[model samples]
Target chain A: MPRVPADSQTSAGFDSNLLAFTRELRAEGVAAGTAELLDAAAAIGHVQWSDRAAVHGALSATLAKSPEDLRIFEVVFERFFFRKAEETALQRGEEVAGKDPGGEQAQRIDLEALKQQIATALQEGGEGSLRDMARLAVAAFGQTQGGSGVVGVDVQRIRRSLGLRSEPQPDLPPEDARAEGVPRDRLREFEREVRRELERQTIERTRSLPPARPLGDLQRGLPTGQAADLAEIHKVVAQLRRKLATSGQLLKGQRQSSAIDVRRTVRASLQTGGVPVVLHQRPKRPKRPEIFVLCDVSTSVTSASIFFLAVLHALHDSFRKMRSFVFIERISEVTELFDRERDFKKISRAITSDAGVADVSGYTDYGRVWLEFLKLIESELHPRATVIVLGDARTNGRPAREDLFGQIAARAGRTFWLNPEPKLYWNYGDSVIDSYSEYCTTFECWTAAQLGDFVDALANPRHLPPSK
Target chain B: MSNTPKTAEELASRLTADGYLADTQTALVAWLAIKLGKPVLVEGPAGVGKTELAKSLSRVLDRDLIRLQCYEGLDEAKALYEWNYRKQLLRIQAESADSGWDKVQDDIFGEEFLLERPLLEAITSEEPVVLLVDEIDKTDQEFEAMLLELLSDFQVSIPELGTMTSRSHPVVLLTSNNSRELTEALKRRCLYLWIDYPEAEHELAIIRLKTPDLPAAVASRLIELVAEIRGLDLKKPPSIAESIDWARALLLLGADDIDAKVFRETMSVIVKHRSDLDTVAERVGVKLDGGDAASAS
Candidate 1:
């Protein structure tokens, strides 16, 4: 017969303890599936059984999919596999009672020795012998499998084998009869605390996230108020001025400098034999033309005004003369406001506050604004100055003074209107744009890019070269 | 150089030379659409490369681009004409007509009356025009309807006179941040392409192209790290533009390799939102350097 170690299995190659633990795990909700069992067996076969971390990893990988699942596995694995050391002491107590019948002292010595052995084994890793002693003690002392009775054993024998002193039994209950110590109220409070903490953390996390883009940088570099698309418009404005300068078409101030003005230069040249040479040089008349800009700064058309101002500013440089006015509720002169470089934010605030305007009014009143502009044009505008009105003509049910516009057109060298609103929305509101359209020499859509192109065409005289 | 079918592979190679990388078939189509005068409507998340296509097209074409940024209440005059009032008045005074009404009317509404806005200018330009209509979806439905004529005919009709048509047709390019839906009429008028975020290899190529001076090892590592971060649920995934910014930041700091220390210092370059940074910090087992200085350890 082959002798087996006290800690070894009764039958070779049979892990009876591990099989018992697996059975308990299956009884609980944990499903140690066939694959997991196979993997566990193979892992245990490869690694040293004492390495607990490796075992834990192999089992966890086989069983768990998420954090919640891992937590469940930890609880179930601990309950079924990590047996408590004090369990053997309870078994030893039952053994002493059964062998010695009514002997309490014998039971105390046996229990003390068992407790010492369990503590020693738990501290170190050589707990196989202690596990065997626990099993043997339970088998010998336990009556029937389900019966509630304590067995008896030789206390001195147990004490000498393990290492402990005699002690009387305290009022300890049986392991099965002992109630779980966790308080229901304490557990519920812990759960509530955890939920509140999680809610707070979620709120904080959400608050820390950034807002959507585009909304954050809406009008950063757009043309608005005083700061127009100057660079883009200058090229066009210069061309127009040069075209007028070279044409000698007697454009307003050009009449005084016309080569065909024989009465003036020729009369003076008679003193030089009518050669018209070396006559007292005729003074170059300043080409200071008047320009009126009627911009619609209504909430719906504010962006349109920025591009108009850009073209106006560029034209001002080319013409060296212009009077600009912005209108939403009423027309107000903003030429001085636009002379400097001001961004939309600053100019928008100033315009709203009635800054740089003779009068302050809210919202675009196209009819009233145009009437006011017509009054200024007839009374103060030089006949030589060109009158330009910029607006979308959406007057919001207000009267459109088409007759006043016609009168201004009659008095000035030319009266022109710029409508930023698309033609489709022309007749929808107080948009008397169609009525005013009759007075405008040319009406076209003026987006920022288009405004720049138009100004460049006006500025560069080469495109519209001076007449031969 | 070869007369092949110009596959996505070929386009990708060309884009690499131009300092861009064509990652997906959609991006390749977008690149081709731009080159071939087809309008591309790129719609995606905010950080994705919708608007960047226009900028890159400007660089690639080497043309003076005209951009018409669309928004609420964007109308024709702002997009197209204004009259020369001062010049018209001067003309009226110079003519000295006894019948001033007729003279003013004719003078105000003459050739001098016409103001060439962007659409008209692009149409009339002798040189090739790259007209970028940016963020078209922001404008109202009526605006979209108005664009049909301009996009189809490259001409605008002024009822006062007749249709003003283009002498030189422009390469019409329109972009939408997709604030709202655009009209079907507008969509039907042109060829469409959509741009998406780059894949791994293309993203790597983009980083290399953008930061040519960066060491190859650093660029590759940065791309890999950013790609990994994108996999996580982030508030703002690192865009191609952001990736370039991050790579540049790293190169500026003299980091030839991406490591925990370097990444911690330059987290802001790639991860814009505070929440995104926190989430990334937690997921990657790193410390949030500033503010609370909390450690994952």
Candidate 2:
């Protein structure tokens, strides 16, 4: 609860004060959603007007998610909502020197001057008894500030001057005979009444402040910027690459000296008097498979693409030569986008644009993209390449061009088709996944987790033999 | 009196005296897994006491911890046992003159030539071991599939050796940061728990416990302020470990109060990032001049 502005108002009786308080909560990074706000209002509505503790408890329960949320709510609520009379005095500018007489003016400045005189007297050291000091401080603060006077001294400050750190000393006699020139008992009664009223008013002002809303209720589904998630994706990928590099795999482009055929080495050693000797050996090169990736960049598959790009970036080091293309209503070759520092947004934007071969339209034309892909394959497909096509296979019920995919499958080492949509959505609408499934070595890629698994299988093909 | 306590300290103490290390909830979970005969899967933000729970549990329970750290490309051979090809080759070469191929093949692929990794070691150990599979979310699905049978039955299978069942049932604790949602099969095999940052009072108690020499006032103020910052929507919130660090920093500097000057000088104790510190400094509006007694109070 923060101090709300006096003039603020809301349709739900959430006046300027409440709005300002909620604003401060938001600024403090609490999730302060509309639902939590409505809940706070409901809780506040149920509480009795006089029971401050019940109101505070209700508001806390409505808003707080955890103990940490409660603690923060308490501090912020106190700072923002509690309106101390001392602050009221500061607003008046009466007690300090060079005071401003603007806005609201205090009625009696003489009482503040007298209180200052007594405080000065006490600071001058030992001139007055403790009773004398208490009398002077209270009379000056209470009389001047208490009545209808605008400019009155702070009684809490007077109590503080009387060596009372918190509340006034409980054991103090209420009488001040020397200063008031009255009977001790009578003076005591008057002083007690004034002290009680002052204490009551102070409590009323501070306790009337609203309770803070719980941070957890406010924080649910709060939008985290895309940059943060992207950075996290980057970090995870880098860590993955580092772990892979350390697993005794050769760094890309670093060739091994030779592959020692165990049988041949042993046979040569036996021929050379059973002693292992230098033997000429030709280097054995592991097959470097070419990979072609096609990704769907439709709005529905955007979340899936984020993970798809991360896996593609990670596998760049392992693959011999990789070509990537993304399509929605068009087919485009984005092999150059596989460079180490390519911007993801730029690639996504480029793939969805009309600058590519197939015409840009609202829905994918699988037949058009497939025909274009076939043309490129006939001209540029390497004998050792693996073709990977990723999409939901929705083409608005047009021709699926399954024959082109089948022909491409025949030329490549292996073909994989990945779909971000669930398997249940495969046969619906314009999706031709069922038709294209026959040509693919594997046709599965539903979640980001599955996408990563599929990419790893492609990059590290030693685990699985090449499909016929 | 009713038994439920409001404060974490009271709960922690009660749990501790019940023959459990109470403050470390993550470790308590791992210990409970052994008692309950269930695998524990703990998930939360990083540095919120996920992996440390496993480490602490190993110490508290007096069991050897077999740690299998998961990564993107971790496979069965890396997690379980792999055939020692070099050792097998040496054996084959040594036996070539005297032994036939059949005897040589049998000797090379024998259990003696198998190199046990973390998973295999946990399953084979005679003494009860705590197997900590750290950050399972980082690994691919295939690797996760490999752990499903092992985690559920406490057994691992090799093509040559068939299946190896646990000699002494190892208490399994798997941790993830939720980088990706785990397959339901893996989640179903374990008892799930989510560990969060401790409350302010609990953090204060932890500070006092870990750094006893610190002034009570300083620790209290540090806990209060750090608790305030955690309420903010920063990229990274300070963890409980950081609260202890901040208290120690204040004790070293001989400061008793939390003022703007001390806060600026020792901001690093609570805030690890520059941007987060800047945000905290702007939000905490009180100024201290080493003379503002009222403000300090």
Candidate 3:
């Protein structure tokens, strides 16, 4: 007989494991269906079983639908394969018991003190470290299924201590006997009671505690765009820049250079008789594309606009030239200020620093802004340049001049509108996004994630980046 | 060639013979695709050597490399199979001049008038062929549908002929730069492999294989500079093919070391974008000129 399970050692083991893992993945909102799972299973035959990276690659190829799915698969794969039951068992063995043996008969396991430790950890450590400690607390005192801190084992000792059943259950304490001899079950009861009490107290404490400042993934779920903290916006810009814009020299790879210089190569071949010893290639890089940024700095979408400009400013090396304009009721150029400033901290102030360009505060008339700009600087706009507009598209019932926007879009290479408001508000109220979206590639970007998608699309405009 | 490594350990060895190296996963996938008679869909960003894998497979397999380079508006007539209409017209004229038009007209739609494209050519070839449908994402959805059918059946249907099946069906490989999202139906039909930029050690192996004559220090410096540039924000990034080309360019210049002067003169070899060149000159140039170590961050 094999020491491990029959399925674990064989290729059949991997197949079942893959199926079960895909099921978990589907439960987690990844759209991995039956056919995808089967494809993933088939892929395992080609890759080395011992090589987890190879297995990951094979599964990612079969299971993942897009680059987003691939990222999810990486996380799911670690949760499924790397964090298995055996490792969890080893971890359980390593966990220290919470009971103090020095005190006579362990002094009924301090529930209040345990709750205090948890509250302090929750306050001091981040969510990641807190979750780890919570899992450890559960493991050491409470009975849990395994390593994953998601669910704890049924609170058997707690139910026993409280005496939930009216009659004496088999192998359980007699209902009346709890009135006499409840002392025998106290050690086990101590473990279970502390976990339950700690959990309840921890929840109450965290609710009273202020929300963490540097928003973790816990706070990333909401679609709060402009409302996000300034530091969070900086984090988002740096992240999006890395993921979407920063093109690596060793990444976007090579192409077959067109039309080898045969005359030059052949002439050089004369050094080794008629055979071409060396081939010469005159490879040329493709011409850089231009981006024209038009930002609206009204009071409403100021934060979003600042981040948009900050990210674009930071990524100026990617394009040939990026001419920036800030508009309130009229437009004016701020390229010189951005050209001088590389620090993002300084950029936030510099964007809204000059009150003159932003028309010195008034009702945001977008039509007037477009009319004023088109009349003065239409010559600067080129067919090869993409104009990106950052606004909420709330025109305050002013004349939107959608046709003027359309004409500008027609003359330029391409047009994109990034509205800071959630897409649910696109056609609602005074949002003229409905009228404007028809003329350009318009989308809602209320968060860094959305902005990342937008930036990715801008970098490679051949296709829209699919939602992660 | 006779002594080519047959096992997994030898896969790297065998592929290295051509100055191209494959990681264990890619090697395993290639071996499996050949053994299992399944099409392998390779997808990645541009310049990661997706097409080079096909060439390497063709070389390793000792088969004719049939490539159907995909583009927009690529229809079945160009991709899979098309009838030889011109040849048919000539034959019709010749047959009518000699025999009656009745027999010639019936035979005009036969296999004699059939013109086999890459897919059909690979299917009908006696020896196993390595069929490369390069840049499938560039083509439209209709071409993908045709590929789905052809890939699944391993044969093509013709009105003139019933169906031509091969005794030895070709090993199919489809590559995409992921410019456009391919349909799920197409991805499900094949084994998948994504080729990324190799790690430092993996890339060094490839560099050594491609430019065997280069000094070790120079190779290290070239890779080091590329890694540094990769960290910078730029428009178009250099790929593996570019690294090889850059290495070749440096060798031609006969530069003994990577210093400010050599890098200043030949910076364009690696940096393709004008803006990126400017950034590199400003960032990397200052370090090199400061009389600091060449490998300064």
- lDDT for each residue of candidate 2 in A269-311, tens digit (9 for 90 to 100): 9978877685656455445567888766654455566656655
**Cα deviation of A303 in candidate 3 (Å)?**
15
Off by over 4 Å in 3: A1-13, A28-31, A46-51, A86-446, A449-468, B1-9, B97-102, B290-297
Report lDDT (Cα) of residue A240, candidate 1. 52
| Residue A315 miss distance in model 2 (angstroms) | 34
DockQ of 3: 0.13
Which runs in model 2 stand beyond 4 Å of their true positions?
A: A1-468, B1-28, B285-297
lDDT of 2: 0.60
Greater-TM-score candidate between 2 and 3: 3
Q: Model 1, DockQ value?
A: 0.01
In the range A1-468, model 3's lDDT, one tens digit per residue, is: 312222344776666677778876775566777666665666676556787766776677667766556656665675465335324434555322222222332244354454444444433445454444444454434432222222122233333223333222244333333322222223233433444334333333343322212322312233323222444666776776565444433224544446688889999999989889789876554435687888887765654666666656755634547877888887888777778877654565566666465554455788988897788668977888888888889898889999999888888888889888666457665788888887888877767677777777776655574321
Q: Which segments of model 1 are wrong by more than 4 Å?
A: A1-468, B1-15, B23-38, B47-49, B84-90, B93-100, B285-297
lDDT of 2 by residue, B1-297 (tens): 133233334444554444333444333333335544557777766776677677765665567898999999998789898999999988988879999999888778789999999999998999888799999999999988988889878898888878899898887888897778787667655655666677666677677776778888878877778766875546688887677678778888888787777887788777878777776666652434454433543
Q: What is the CAPRI rating of model 2's predicted complex?
A: incorrect
The residue pairs that clash in candidate 3, if any, are A249-B238, A253-B47, A254-B47
Q: TM-score for each prediction?
A: 0.36, 0.39, 0.54
Worst 10 residues of 2 chain B by lDDT: B1-10
lDDT of 1 by residue, A155-268 (tens): 212222332212211233333111122122222232222222222222233433122112111112223322224333444555655654654444444344434554677787
**Clash count list over all predictions:** 61, 16, 3
